[model samples]
Target: MTAVVSLVEHAPARAFPLPDTVGRALAASKILEEAAPDSYERGMWRLRAGSKVGVVAVAVPGGETVTVRITPKVPVARLFFLLGYSSDPAGWRDGMVDVAEHSELLPALAHAVERQTDRALRRGLLQGYRTVEEASLVVRGRIREAEQIRRRFGMPLPAEVAYDEFTTDIAENRILRAAVDRLLILPGVPQTVRTRLMRQRARLADITPLVRGQVIPAWRPTRLNTRYHQALHLAQVVLDGASAENLPGGLRMDGFLFDMNRVYEDFVCAALREALRPYGGRSALQAKDVHLDECDSVRLRPDFVWYADSGTPRIVADAKYKAGKRRGYPNEDLYQMLAYCTAFGLPEGHLVYAKGSAPHTSHRVRRAGTVLHQHALDLDRQPEALLAEIRELTRRMVAGVKGRI
Candidate 1:
């Protein structure tokens, strides 16, 4: 039987009587860390978890299996909401992807993926035209004259032909297949879910399995693929967030983890962008072309930036998931936003943070005369209430821009 060590996100370090191999593996992986020497305990290893939450199973020497499970600070359902909203703000609803049945993240995600994939394949696999080029006995479509002359020496037989072949082995089915396979490997998936995932894999047997490191094939949303849109989105989340790796000395590690910092940032940017749509301006997440200096030496990428129809920057904001100090949000974040304000020539900039003891506050830089606003969002709130907060925040941002004009 595999030993299990459970920890909560950002919780205090705990000591565990673990084998040296397992301890060293977890320490080297950096998914969990050893406690500082001052807090260290004798005869046991002290391990602490940060913001990453998920289950990782490490297979060490002596045929021992150790599983480390990190629970998130927020409810699993709320985390799913953040994930779904970040991926598809317009289409994602609270219960659209059912995860209420499972308490753990891995099981919940696996169940959701299985259900969505089943729905997507209910009408059978989608078929699309794939352009294929090969040497064939009979030329079906366009023939490569240059290749025919160069390789075949003008031989009439085995012509190099290119044609579009309609098949089930397309990008959509392939992604779904990859997600199913990934879940089937990870630990903690219920046997029932695993069985269903196996069936999904069988259904997608004809489709090509994705290579481990290669980019996932892209698929577009259209009327024909409307049924696949939800499944495809979830499939990508699985492919991008989960990892399986093999280490030296017969050690293997695999898990699905979510970084709260990334999740919070993505949710804030996506929600704000969706809320700002009604204001009739363009919004960008992580705008890359921005800079703080005229020489373009100091490039700055703000989490969110809104632009006017006239191609001028209207508002800029950054998202911070870190805890605020007793005074307020960190001063470093204020300095970063100030730079953004100066670069965009805006009178005000916004800093959105996860709700802490500190209330919403605004600071005016004395010399620059730029107003920097700090906004807090409570993640524990219901989906509707959380979105309403974003809508209200959008209003404040737009009002600030108008005041400047």
Candidate 2:
């Protein structure tokens, strides 16, 4: 049966009937829970990401199943860049090409996979085998083994010799093969792409199957091997959670999921850093050990903290992934931001939320000498426009700080 797959970002719940097998997979992944208890034919599921991003598949043996690729709601190109950024703080964009027109996550993933594979192939599969030293009667690596065995053993007719040699179990080949093997099982990968991957995999015929949790060797940097860096990282990301389940009917596999909170927070903090760079201030993310109480026990970790050159806190900003329209901002969020401003002795704090009905709003704390600015960023906007909004916010924040100074 054809798979029923849906690509969705972190959003509202989606309902669909799921077979017991597929339901179990989703449940294990914590992506969904049964909406209605009674009927096996009726089930509900939604995207639940806990600090991860990418494609993850859900399937059932010999039955219809759904493969949901949880990704960012932003434009496909931006999302790709963001994913690339999340993996590495720098240098992830080197091999990535322009792919904004591709909307869905699967196609984008396939495109990346194909491109990376081709790049790795062009660089030549980093092929250096490990030494496999063993004692044998038959001649192998060198006659030194036979001489050693002859000296050790009294029976000289059939000499037991120690031989030193290497096997075909290579690091680069294994990683590439693992990636290709994973792509082949991923449900929505096109036939052409799969064929390409297969060809790549076949070239690494001597490579042993990469065992789960096996440590992939980190190759040293060199001019010739630099091209393999991005592909190796991609291969690792694709093969990290690659799994296949053998059941009574058939085999099923799983894919990837990402946390929207992390994505939003990272994007905002990174953009804010770039936006604030020219202003000559310090920006720290996940600032640590902020005491909320005099006891030094209660602490708060604000997402981003901008400090003036004088070492005074200017803007304490937090990124909220939820929409304000849906149930509005939590009272705790306000209290937390307020405490951030108060603790830092700042006149105002900032809360950046994803797009909502109210794009920008502010709240003044009466008699508290503190104000809270809430700004919403539309992640769906063009990359330049999105960063521009962040820059505008930074300017206002800097101006607000300068006014007080």
Candidate 3:
């Protein structure tokens, strides 16, 4: 049995009692903290869902019958879809159908993993052997009997061989297999999905179990490796959500935290760059075009910079994941954009917000020629519609630039 705790977005903290075994797990994981002196429960947790929505789980002890589940008020499917954009924008559509059909985050993730694994299996897992040089009777690469003799004389024979061979037990396969293994144990995973995941894991028998804190090796992009990239990416996301701890049992997860702020920023920047391709202008993310001070010690990094044909900064844009005009557009953001415009010698800048009362608005500096345009994206909308909105914004940016030119 699991303890399902419902928390309203940005609401006051709520208390819940846990079994001693489970309580120990939560404390070790820090998923829940002690409430004030007045509250009687073992721990209190508050959910700050803000404008983004999704589900994350807390792992408990073996004997304990309680599990902590945090559910967001927003549609879980939509949230997962938006979250997917953070990791993959171009290929997100590849998983949206399954994402919208699943009600929980973990299942949706499972579906993604299964599909990617199937695709990878069809294409064939990349093979590359990690090199090893050892003293052996059989000669593989070369013999270093002299060094072996220097260190210690072998009783029978002495030879050192360094070689590389083909293997299916690479990091890519191990990571995918590990994620599948973890999902199989998670509650609320669909039986059908579990069956599919089990099959996928079986195919990766040669790969070793990914130990906790093991660094996944990076793979180069080739025809063989490219097919595994998306699958590997999704696997990494699932693996990162699971944290290991020393508690009543060997290791268990506390939960996963998805930072919607970073997700929105990455999506917006990537979408804008793609949208601007038709206009023949290049968009640079985290463009370091300006230094705030004379010493160049302090520098300004605008989220995006659109460069004109002549190789000059035409426009700058920033992504903000907040609500309404009051909270979304702050003095700090305005000041930062003003600095970007002044430094780049541009008269216009763009700010993309998560949600706003109006679709668009413009702000002009009190004593300057710069104008900041604010735009909003409703995350609840379909993924395709969201991309279309970005495309429209790009058109507006291009038109504005042309008029000035």
Give the winner by TM-score. 1
**Rank order by lDDT, top first?**
1, 3, 2
Worst 10 residues of 3 by lDDT: 45-54
| C-alpha lDDT score of every prediction, in listed order | 0.88, 0.67, 0.69
- lDDT of candidate 2 over 150-208, digit per residue (tens): 56665533444444334446666677777777777777677776777777777777678
User: What C-alpha lDDT, on a 0 to 100 scale, does residue 228 get in candidate 2?
Assistant: 72
TM-score of 3: 0.79
The Cα error of candidate 3 at residue 315, in Å, is 2.3
Off by over 4 Å in 2: 2-7, 10-14, 24-28, 33-56, 59-66, 69-72, 85-102, 125-178, 202-210, 215-253, 309-311, 326-331
What is the C-alpha lDDT profile of model 3 across 84-181, one tens digit per residue?
67666666663443553776666777887898788888856678777667877787876666776676576446565667757887777788888888
How big is the positional error of residue 54 in model 3, measured in Å on the Cα after superposition? 5.4
Every model's TM-score: 0.94, 0.72, 0.79
Candidate 2 lDDT trough over 10 residues, lowest sum: 32-41
Give per-candidate clash totals.
0, 8, 0
Candidate 3 achieves a global lDDT of 0.69
Best by lDDT: 1
